[model samples]
Target: MITDDKDFEAKSIIARMQRIDKWPLPPSFLAIIALGYFFTFYDVTDIGFAMPSIAPQFHLTGSESLFLALSIGLIGYVIGSFIIGYLADRYGRYPMLILTMILMALGSFGDAASVNLDMLIVFRFITGLGLGADLNLIPAYIGEFAPAEKRGHLAQITFFLGILGQAVTPFVALAIVPPFYYGWRVLFLIGGLIAVIAVVLRAELPRSPRWLIGHDQIKKADDVVSKFENYLKSNGETLPELKTDDINKINVQTETTRLSFLYLWQKPYRLRMLVFGLWWGLWYIGNYAFLGDAATILSDSGISLASSILFLAIGAIGYPIGAISSWAISDKFERKYIIFVGSILWLIGMLIFGSKANSIALIVGSFIASYSLAFLIGIAYMYTSESYPTRARTSGFAMGDGLGHIGGAIGALFLPLWVAEIGFFGGFAFIGITTLIAGIILVVGGSIATRQQLETISA
Candidate 1:
């Protein structure tokens, strides 16, 4: 049905874009972004490991105090995500990313130096703000730069690295917390140092070309793309002549529309936003409720604190494994289907773990649950960012993820109460049911987003 000129134009654009993908800069680019995310995860997960030690020092014996300590950061996360997402879209990705890194560094040090519970909570909230912004921005930045064919894989790779930061936290805690007892402060200090290093390294990275084009910075976008083309030429790859028409097409599509928060509530974007928000919120409620309190839950079930940490460390191995699985399968299957299957697996795992709180069941079920959660995370980041156009991509992801933090915060608040009131089985049952509901929602409403161009998907 297409005319010859139109067909030629499509092919030309595809060819030009394909060359950009083949450029050699992606691995290093991904590495820099991944390193930044690594510290974010490290800082967040370290708090869980530190809490057992922190409770005694701060007299945080009551469930209310513990919940306040745990959930306050998520409150900051929600606020920062919404605000930074808008700023990233309006100002730029790189600048906001750098700013967050600085905030994280300062906040981590502040957390390290806290003399009272109030100070600790304030610092944790500040750190959470940076974490929330980074979470929303990193995926958006990567999604904008990566080729459609490899976008899912690259995004998962960064997420995988970040999970590794989390996976190692238990070991780090075991190594430091017991021997020194005061070593919890040292953990925050290390996180601060690493964050400072990431900021320095990330400064060398370039801004997103897709973002540039979306903002009507056509000349800047062209220059960035040209640098990639030149790199390919220097590396001995043959490339087609640059197509002016293809460039114009991108500019035309992206330039006319100015994105706002209200835009997400209209037309096709509304449904997608609703789906993404539900998916993110439900997953966070179940996953954070379980994993965030894994050690405490196990300890309550008669396991020794040391033994629980060991069990948690063993279970944490599933994060990287599941991420690797997501990496391999991401582009091959529809992301919605992947998320649906992961939710089912999570439910099944929670049921198995909840049915019995013995060491063996806890270890095995935790692994399964952790693995399934990782699969969802790897794909969710890609799906959320890609579901919207470049102009609104950061804001869209921020809104969904920010709203999702409410579920996580509430779960953090209530999971301990649930454990105290019922038992481990009852707590797991609650999360399993939540996971099943999420799976059903996805099955009924999720969209397919496999190896599709962001613009085409958004359109």
Candidate 2:
């Protein structure tokens, strides 16, 4: 475990990083960060492909069954995010990350061994709890460790891997889901294996030196910096000494001690809280609810499973691509603008898709909606990451993400019901209107509020 005390001059975090050493890879930091994230994400998305098959096996009513899989786990995620996010600040990011991975892996294995719906939901909830921790912690961990120039680029990996996992679902299902008695179980096992491998790879990764110093573990921070410099040397880079002025910045004075969940509601931060939580929730209202309920929606319109999954995958492909683009440009645009554009695209696509559900045009339009939603999600993650001070980033994102998960939970309840009562077209229209309202709210008032912006302005 990396400790938080060692001797050296205090200096700015970014300046220390630049001087430590550069890797041969173009942003070697991103490569390591991306790999860690891939495992975490593969767990989240690997279940989507199984949704269609699993719903029937469990005798799920359209929304009820989907919610069983989605809402239950999401609820657990909300709880875990709140708990683990606060702990990340208390215990240290790397320690929390490793523990979360273990929990997620255990949950996956447990799910694989379950016998019935009750048992399945329980294990899924457990899996979700660990996943929730990953969702809150990983982005904050990445953002803090990265240089400002590439923060968005690095942060985007989480979103990109999430989509990548979604993209691979079809293949994973085709190969591993069913025909064998243990198909569903196989999905959980796969996630566990990936997580274990990621754990091994991350052994060399260090804690955020900034976080250590912030907590007054100056010696431990120095040791981390020294190890990182040595690692860079092995990669053919030179070590730079930490400057006193930079250290002073990293150790900025703050009275806040235990990062309480209540901090999310304090003034100035509260407005930020409202923006992130509401926007995230609304984004899901448009995305997952639509996607989770998609198979049933298409089937009602007389589409085949083959066509449905293909279009869904195509829609998903847009996520990573759009995420990568946003990651590259996020620093350049105000967070509000990126989210606004994505929501607009979502509204437009959903409206067009709902109106033309019976036509091939709707399929094309639905795909567009999917792409825009992915772009919006990528932007949302970046914005959430940028919304809080480093000390509270995970907690802020967790609360906001929890709000988003609620949207998913709501979609799990309402989408199928709406489709049943008013038809799939009407259902899409309803969500479209809601999502558009979410966009309007942000456009009217949302702005970047994270400490990163403060640093930039001061610089």
Candidate 3:
């Protein structure tokens, strides 16, 4: 918790840093981060398409085996994320990001070469670790660097670019997965290649100055912040004046720790983590329940394989569109409110998809569900990242979201059985209902942080 002792001296670099409202870095720098994130979406999304081909070879005809395969990566994700988050907090964001890409590449390439389902599952665990770490650190990393006013806007843009992976991967899968027995392997190869490339690209990203401050590398932190200040001066743009009163109100946010995720258990941080964790876990439960089997469900319900891919591909357009919408509005309103609206919209869309098996309904409902679900995601990320101080942010998020992933695993595990009992309509409706509950919990329990500096809000 913050206290008077934690306050910085006059001429505080953080106070000076907070005075700027625009990004100090070059606009193009966000590209590589988004590019690295693209692989994550592709790896998660391509599984549904690849499963049809995979099942025949692996003999996963039973629902139990299918669901187990679907849920294993997520189980791995939980473990990997928590470990990586702690490491990132203790080490540094830039180094951890590179490590995450390496792990993902290893997992992807390993999956491509797997001789059996067991081999595939083992490799997938490796992949999940990378994914979990990426998801935890990226939002916190972004929030740490972003000007308070545009934090949400910049994150939404990065996600919008990253989300194109979901938008583009189906077409890639359509071309590869159906024509050959080993076509799915090619998809994995592509994901691996992207990860290798991201390593080189993301090497260019600067470390989070906030993270440096949290670790007591104050001189390094100032040097990093000074780059942005110097950049503004070079452009013939004056830096905003830091007021004495505003500076007095500002407290340097930090805590010294060694492998101490225990900091999260303290009072308001504990409560905040609970709310964010549940929201993260529950949202994934709904998405994994439907998304992992969406194509299969459609195929069984009489939609042709080709048509199912087409519908999914088209509907996937919603990911970027929804991201654009988030970019436009996330900075303007409290993020929890956006999450609430998204849940309602997702519920309506899921209902439409489950109501019947018609083509038009499939197209429209998937579109709505795609974008609305994206709403719960990126906005919730912003909310989660903003809730904690720099020292515990990534690890705290890791523990919270990692445990929440159990809900995802459970949803994927039981979904096939549940669908057998009540069918697709009932399955999707259940997801929608659970989503609504999570949304309500988030809005009621999460902090109100619109337009607030991360230090001020977390304090």
List model 1 lDDT by residue over 345-372, tens digit each: 8988888888774778877887888788
Candidate 1 residue-wise lDDT at 322? 87
With candidate 2 superimposed using the best TM-score fit, by how many Å does residue 14's alpha carbon deviate from the native? 6.3
**Candidate 1 clashing pairs, residues 3+ apart or interchain:** none
Better model by TM-score: candidate 1 vs candidate 2: 1
lDDT of each: 0.79, 0.67, 0.83
CA error at residue 101 for candidate 3, angstroms: 0.7
| Model 2 residue 239 lDDT score | 60
Q: Which segments of model 3 are wrong by more than 4 Å?
A: 1-11
lDDT per residue as tens, model 2, 154-207: 566656765676566645655666455567678778878877766666565678
Clashing pairs in 3: none
lDDT of 1 at 312: 74
TM-score of 1: 0.93
* Alpha carbon lDDT at 207, candidate 3: 86
Q: How well does candidate 2 score on lDDT at residue 46?
A: 58
- How many residue pairs of model 2 clash at the backbone? 14
